[model samples]
Structures are given as C-alpha cells and as structure tokens.
Target: MQLSKKSRYGLRALIDLASAPENQYVSLSNIAERGEIPAQFLEQVFASFRRAGLVKALKGPQGGYQLARNPKYITAAEVLEILEGSYRIADEDVSPESRCYAVSETIQDMLIGPVNQAMETILGKLTLADLQRSYQERATQSEDMYYI
Candidate 1:
C-alpha cells in the first residue's frame, strides 16, 4: 500500500524531532525546513498529532512542539494510524453476490490479510527512535563519502 504524503511527512518530521536533544521544543517551521516539507502542511499534520496526544505545543516566542512521550514508546504503526487513518492494503468490503466475490474473499484471506498482519507486526515494532537512528546513520554515511 502506498503511504500518503501526510504520513510520510509526519514520520519524517517525527524523526527530525527525535534527533533533537531530549526535552527540547522544536519549532514546526524548523522541522519543515529541515525535512523539506511545506510549512503549512506540516502545521496541519502537527495539529492532528497534537489532538491525538502524540505531540505537545507551546506558544509565544520560544513556542514550538515536542513529542509527548519518549520516542521509544511511540511506534511507527501508531504514527501512521494517526496520520493516515488506516494502513490496510485493501478494503475488506466485497459484495457476496458479485461473480468475483469468492475470488476476492480468497485473496483477502490468503494474501491481503497476511500482508496487512505482517505490516502491522513490522510497523508496530518500529519506533521513532529506530527511525531517528536509521536517518542519522544514513546522513553520516553520505557525509563520509568522498567526491571523485
């Protein structure tokens, strides 16, 4: 299943936040600039996260945002769910009267269901801290590369 831009940007922003010093409040604009995400779009994404208690926002000159909890406690599945609603590969709704209903049921039972389950297993185990580490590693590797 293809992830929506909102989900992708949200995850990227979260990883950016996770990379910051602990207990630091980072401005959304800074995150948007760092991640190359649109400031307006990131604002909307952060609103959803704020409503879901995934993030906290502060107001005023030093105002910004921060994760509500430790990155290790927040899973990718949870973030995707908040940003994209559902991460299921396919809708289970199939008219039983349709000619392909049986085929569809087989596909759902044998393929879609298992795939969604596996996705859930992987995403559920992948926390924001894990993403942060991965991003840092990649950044480090790229920086270490020498130009010809």
Candidate 2:
C-alpha cells in the first residue's frame, strides 16, 4: 500500500507538535515551516486532523494547534488513518465466480491479510513521540558528525 503525501505531511506536523511540551501550542505556520510542508496544504491537513479529534485548534494572538492527547497514546496508524482513510489493500483476484482463479484469489487474500497485519504492527507501535525522539537523535548525530 502506498502512503500519500497527505499522510506524510500530517505525520510530520504531528511530530512537531509532539515535540512541544504538553499543553503547549504551536502555530500552523510554524509547524508548516518546520515540517517543510506548504502552508496551504497544511491548513487542509490540520482541518482533517481536527475533524478526526487528533488535534485541537486554538484561536487568538498566541493561538495555534496541539495534540488532543499524549503522543505516546497516539499511534502512527491512527494518524495515517485519519489523514488517509481506511488502510486496506485490495484483493484483485478474490471472486467467487472465477473458479480458475481460486488459487490466485486465496493467495491474494492471504497476502493482503499478513501485509495489513505487519503494517498495523509497525504503525501501532510507532507514536508521534517516537518520531520526535528519532528526529532529535538524527539532529544530534548530524551535529556530532559535523565536528569530526
């Protein structure tokens, strides 16, 4: 299954927010700039995340957006599902009428099931906080390498 740009950008934005202290808000423009996502596109993505209850938007001078819950409580799968919709791989050959394609159909279904499960396992295990820490490590490593 191919992940769309929307999902990727949304996840990036979430990671930014996750990096912030709890109850802290980060402006959309700030997140967009930091994530390298276009402001216009991030606006739409934020709207979808808000609708999914993954984020809460605040309005005012110091207003912006924040995660609705703890980062560790939010899974990557949940974020992607909100932005990308149902995560289902299609079973192309699964048809009852196609007797000759029964084996292919069975194999397709089997493959889809395991693939879906593996995706779920990875996404479910990964949280926005995980991404935040990952980015932190990368940044630190880069800095360290630069001094070498």
Q: What is the TM-score of each candidate against the true structure?
A: 0.93, 0.90
lDDT of each: 0.93, 0.86
Per-residue lDDT of model 2, residues 54-91, tens digit only: 89989999899999988888998898888878776766
Q: What lDDT score goes with residue 82 in model 2?
A: 86
Residue 31 accuracy (lDDT) in model 2: 92
Model 2, runs deviating above 4 Å:
none
| Residue-by-residue lDDT tens digits, candidate 1, 1-148 | 5889999999999999999888889999899999999999999999999999999999989889999999999999999999988897965787999988999999998999899999999999999999999999999999999998
Name model 1 segments beyond 4 Å from true: 95-98
Best by lDDT: 1
Residue 97 Cα positional deviation in candidate 2, in Å, after optimal superposition? 2.4
- Total colliding residue pairs, candidate 2: 0
